[model samples]
Target: MPSSAMPASRTDLDQQPPAAITAAGLRKSYGDKTVLDGIDLHIPAGSVFALLGPNGAGKTTAVKILSTLVSADGGTARVAGHDLAADPQSVRAAIGVTGQFSAVDGLITGEENMLLMADLHHLPRREGRRVAAELLERFDLADAATKPASTYSGGMKRRLDIAMTLVGTPSIIFLDEPTTGLDPRSRQNMWQIVRELVAGGTTVFLTTQYLEEADELADRVAVLNDGRIAAHGTAEELKRLVPGGHVRLRFTDPTAYRSAASALRDVTRHDEALALQLPSDGSQRDLRAVLDRLDAAGVEADELTVHTPDLDDVFFALTGGTTVPHQAEEASR
Candidate 1:
């Protein structure tokens, strides 16, 4: 990746942007169920922060509270430098929200939908038209602007939905599973849109059940489980928390394989395949150690591959095997 497109490092404390959103001990409950027990967050400006979880894990609830659409039972939060409780109007003014479901009005033309959002933000008539026109073209909706939203495909509707959200020019946006029902190609397009938003200095708070989406887009990720934060860090940091990393060595000669299997201190053997799996963190040092051991044994492997735990491994380990819903499953819903 180019340096310009690289995300700011979390460890660069001195260069950290001001907090776009901050909450401490935030709690919420609906009737007998506690949606959020006590969650704390500090998201930096111009960064993409993703909240991930299984179904009913309070990801949406967290977005709702931070966006000022719902009130928290306890704790305090500040969004866009305004207290969520004492200055909700200001918070609303500085932010935009796109929920899990499409908010596009099928009865109205796409242009009309954009105009409606412009009106909601209280832009002047002429300015509203200009903004709407510009955004329509930006999202490649110009040709379909006059058509009713209902006539558009799933991808077009999603694009229009985001275009409407940008009408207010909000510095912060809360996206609650924005790509849930999108096809793979459409999802990639949406990811590009998110990248552009952050590149232009917008802070995005995203919630999703798609682990790969979080891994791809988020500068920092927080995994929510059972109404609390299970883990929060960069994708790499979270992956390191899981312990299934290893190095695999395959040999064409059975004799070489046996020599390696005997020389290695601890290995999982695959006798039929003539392979040995050695425990490793997949670091360069670990790899070097394994190579040294192979040299000592006077054995050479035909193929060597490093295997490191990914987000799926981290998610399963952190959430106790609760699987993230796949795209097919989400589309069915």
Candidate 2:
């Protein structure tokens, strides 16, 4: 990739928010099998940080350890400014977690589920009810508050699960594959909810099988592969790490196409389509260079398009094509 396509340096760390979560040398294992091997992370407050990996790559294990659900074999972590090992209670108080599966009680109404979470947080009865009611409305579950959770759709149940997570007003939340099995519309709805959470100054730590989810919501993304962090950066930065970006020119006239193709050096020609593809990083400078060459050649292409790598391309490259299978992850849950 060209230097012009690279992400700008984030040198203004002093102007950024304090980290909502931080970890170093985070190691975990089950007997002979290592789950996490010295992974490190630093997520700023009021931003979304996404973790992506293939099955058994320890994405959920990382979440469990940080959320105080499981202990790390060797590591140090802090959440909401509380040390994970020394003050787990404080960390629990400051954070909430919604795993891949819904934690809602199918036997009870959605309102009951919210109230249950409020009680676990030890809120006053009156205040618990107030927060429960408010959250139910906010998540658009108020109308279904009186119905049993078993009757709710997958999307509604997911919304309820998140609403319950907010009952305690946690400053940080961990969502591990939160939208794994939802329909397209439901998935988009969940994305919107994540946006709303970040807008309200809540730092989100997300793990999802959907690459697009991370691409859409994450301020920064990390790829975990084989119990290690392979790469970590903003979406665009990671995308730029992969090659195969190019600028394509298509011409309707055979004469113009031949002239342009002959003038342009090192281009992949599509004879049937009358198109030429030039290697590029999709940067403005690269585009300008291609256009300059075309202008000098005195040939005008009918169409010009820039093709750059997306998250899918980045994920495949970093993981050696071991992309997360959403259905497989969902089944494991």
Candidate 3:
């Protein structure tokens, strides 16, 4: 149970406003292989929820089931307030999906792709053109709107793909590995677009192998392993589950540094830098205890910094130490 003393702004892990997507006992399998096993999820309206896992861990399967592209073996789901199994047409009308592969037609111009999506949505010709123009400009593809998608760079193609998806202006969107092949700048641009969409009341269901992307963008993150959710919570809450977090105390004064080094015997020391790295969970109680001990020893430090396990650590610890190859490369950089 969480402490009642915690502020209301950041207290509950499961507490949320009305849901945009809900699933219970979601299960799927192919022949003898099970992809998702009794998975459950609740994604709040107008928020970014990230589903994270290694390759082939059912991330795409979950997205497909919810988007009504693939049927689940067992589950009850409601998307955009409509029963997914009962009212798939209504669900489809309220949601958009952008898969790992680019949906852009290389033979067609970016404007053409947008207009195609508009046509699929059965928009009026004049309204379709207006929406395409507005979305193209919003995604910074107005200049290249007339250019063939084949002539666009990888990043530009991705931007155009998302812009085309937005032509229908669905209330909810599912982006599965949306930035897998893009450059760092392009990935960041995609993140910004997600933020703006959420700000405008769009719910985002994001599935990615990148822990950094989840940590930076998601209000809630669920880590899946072996077709089941290993853990689910806010970023900080998940990080707290793993060990190896610590607080570093640095001192400029030789005497104070020496005193702290002696008093804190369990610390990892960097003598040349006059820093003592104390093993801790980076909790408020732990910080208070460390300060009380230092005061008793009459040692004052120059600076303090807390180091905690990042989403990468939490991911590997829960997901059998496996990471996506591309995400690992980006993390190193």
Candidate 4:
């Protein structure tokens, strides 16, 4: 529960870095439908934070408001040491947003798209080209700098979109479903880019439906459901919230399995596989306890593996197994 608020002045901020973003009682609604209900967010600088939800879960709405694309009806927010409402221009200056959809101009070359972003940032002509070239090279788009973005693959387009966002060198960037339609390899490539960004002290706030992506890249994640935060924590902590966790003991010898099953007293036995499954939280202490008891009873397992509920399980459990139309909408795009 550390504060994410930096001091009022940049000089003071240098001594103590505050949270890049902090919000309390952030509310937004459309007509009678509430999109965010008194939500709170605290994002630290230089870390990757993910917000997860199904279609129409208000993930998009939250991003819109935070990025200054939309105004919230109620609440207070601070971004990069500037109050969101009081100084929206400063907020806009300090952050970049790359939505789920590609923003590249299909008619223009990739480098032109980057230069356009530089122009939007108001950099001088020469400086704009320099920044654009650096970002293009950094994002591996140097080869296709002059190629029209329409010719690029889905992954390449997404990379170009992110590179454009960095033109202003914003301290924090919002990536809404950046890798949604990409293949496995492309998705992995995006993840590595995010890692490199954070390593260089850039704060990333991305929204995604891919559970594995969040688990792999995020230092912290929050599950948004029905206009509220259902759960928020590290991947392991969220996984522990669900119930399907166990330690499995497999044996080649039926007699040893049976002996262990008898000694264990409370376990599901698989006669065909000669395995005994004991409910566990998949914690080291729980695993150690199981091992010690087996040793005391002289039961030897041929193989042992710990199984814990993954992020998908946590997502389903927290979001009530609801599928939304937004996913379909994203697909058709």
> Which candidate has the top score in lDDT?
2
Give the TM-scores of the predictions, in the order they appear: 0.85, 0.86, 0.88, 0.87
Relative to the true structure, candidate 1 reaches a TM of: 0.85
Return the lDDT, model 3, position 57. 91
Model 4 superposed RMSD (Cα):
7.0
Question: Which 10-residue window of candidate 4 scores lowest in summed lDDT?
Answer: 324-333
Q: What lDDT score is found at residue 218 in candidate 3?
A: 97
| Ranking of models by lDDT | 2, 1, 3, 4
Off by over 4 Å in 4: 1-17, 253-255, 321-333
The sequence of per-residue lDDT tens digits that candidate 1 reaches over residues 61-150 is 999999888899999999999999999999999999999899999999999999999998899999999999999999999999999999
Estimate, for each residue in 214-267, the C-alpha lDDT of model 2 and write its tens digit.
999999999898898888888866765677788899999999999999889899
Q: State model 1's lDDT.
A: 0.89
Per-residue lDDT of 1-333 in model 4, one digit per residue for the tens?
334543445557676656999888889999999999977888889889899998999999999988888999899989898998899999999999999899999899999999899889999999999999999999899999999999999999999999999999999999999998899999999999999999999999989999999999998888888888777777887776777788899999988998899888579999999999998878889988888888998988999999988999888877886442232222111
Give the least accurate 10-residue stretch of model 3, judged by summed lDDT.
Answer: 324-333
Q: Between candidates 2 and 3, which one is better according to lDDT?
A: 2
lDDT of 4 at 202: 92
**Each prediction's whole-model lDDT (CA):** 0.89, 0.90, 0.89, 0.88
Q: Over the stretch 1-333, how does candidate 3's per-residue lDDT look in tens digits?
A: 477656764656446578999899999999999999999898889999999998889999999999999999997999999999999999999998999999999999999999999999999999999999999999999999999999998889888888888888899999999999889999999999999999999999999988899999999889888898877878877776677789999999989998988887579889899999988877799899889889999988889999998998889887876333333222211
**Cα lDDT over the full model 2:** 0.90
The per-prediction tally of clashing pairs is 0, 0, 0, 1
